[model samples]
Target: MATSLPSHPIGVFDSGVGGLTVVRALMDRLPFENIVYFGDTARVPYGVKSTSTIEHFTLQIVDFLQRQNVKMLIIACNTMAAVAAEKVREISPLPVLDVIESGALCAVAESKTGGIGVIGTPTTINSNAYARAIHQMDPDCRVYSQACPLFVPLVEEGWLDHPVTRLTAQEYLKPVFVEQIDTLVLGCTHYPLLKPMLSTMTGNLKLVDSAIAIADQTAELLQQQGLANTQRGMPDYRYFVTDVPLNFRNVGERFLGRNLGAIEQVSLDRL
Candidate 1:
């Protein structure tokens, strides 16, 4: 795979629309690198699934992405990262990056008080991936985690700052506040969409946008691997989904902060 040219597209996948947050970050950070994104909408919300099931789904998606000849793989989904990241790394020939690793580094760097909170899907929080990652770099840092299952559905619904969203944020964050955490990790890509509401409610806790960390780290890795794209001008982007919901285009556009090109639907059966 190292023999592959830098011009090859980077492959990124998520359970559904939330992973677009990472896609948006990658576009902003590496404008010259083409991207191929896959969303497993048919199996959306890997949060509630067993670890084995999530790993199986992740392997399937990674296999499909590999068929596209992507130069790199970014496991942009938090739940998948929590459960299947190691298996992906062990099996894939491409360099693999995941949100938890970058997010942990950021949390450690941003936490002045040594008290950090992480919020994501129930599966992610239960897996303790973020906590383990943070502890690896800063053993003394206190880690607290919560699962904000409602946030994904709310973001998908485009009710970013709706009264209900705000109310839910308050409930989800109350325990973290009691811990007096000075830093917070938006464990799920979807949670970043609620930054305004999260910020207004969380007081001064520094929020670590894992998307930014992952983007920066990806750029660094690409440069180190000699895989950074040298192409000038615009880079092409292609999107795929396992199942296309009725409002997929609009929701995706909102998450991506731009117009979406052709979005094709795909299924695991083809693999």
Candidate 2:
């Protein structure tokens, strides 16, 4: 049903700048593909909001991105994906991809001992989305979940590898470690920014970075659909935000691992 061309940009959106991590992975995996990213910076921390509110905001973003003529839609925010991914799919004309499903699939495949750990925000963990998803794929695998509410702010603050971060991670992961999990799913997009520190602390535990998993999945989907960009020149990247919060540029640049070019702010009425 999609008449989208290979040259069309892919739309990726999140509650905040965390989705930039997904964008970074996409840039690495699909170098020729253009991307349009939207961050709902004005009303971030969607974790605390009601599901209906989250869904409403997500649909607004989906509507905005659809106007960009994107070939596909990617829900980069774990909370949004958990709450409104199906709703997005229902209305979207393009193929929809979500990080939660990708992360669950990757976690299931990567876990050697059928023991997997999951770390996410309180909302994501409380939703039991990851556990449900993992069980749907592999009912025999044991899922150990922990809610690390502090990781997001820590990552946004750029405290990666800091002593305070290390201590916080250790304390948060103690319960999961006790379960003896062989793979740890980074359920929050922001958590991927802490991969180096998490990897260092967790040693041999495989970390399922949803960003990388979704990027790989997107590449596969693009190839199968014959929508992969054939040209090799520089790809266009556009960023949209609801509001420019304090230190947003700095935090977003860290998450994206590069300079954010031009960021356009859109009003809610327009979204």
TM-score of 1: 0.97
Q: How high is the CA lDDT of each candidate model?
A: 0.91, 0.92
Please provide TM-scores, in order, for all candidate models, with all chains considered together.
Answer: 0.97, 0.96
Candidate 1 lDDT (Cα, 0 to 1): 0.91
- State each candidate's clash count: 0, 0
For residue 188, give model 1's deviation from the true position in Å: 0.4
Clashes by residue pair, model 1: none
- lDDT for 22 in candidate 2 is 96
Model 1: how large is the Cα RMSD against the reference? 1.3
lDDT of 1 by residue, 1-271 (tens): 3456799999999998888999999999999999999998888879899988999999999999998989999999999999999999999989999999999998998889899999999999999999998989989999999988898889888899999999888898888889979999999999889998788887788999999899999999999999999889789999999886556678888989998889988866964
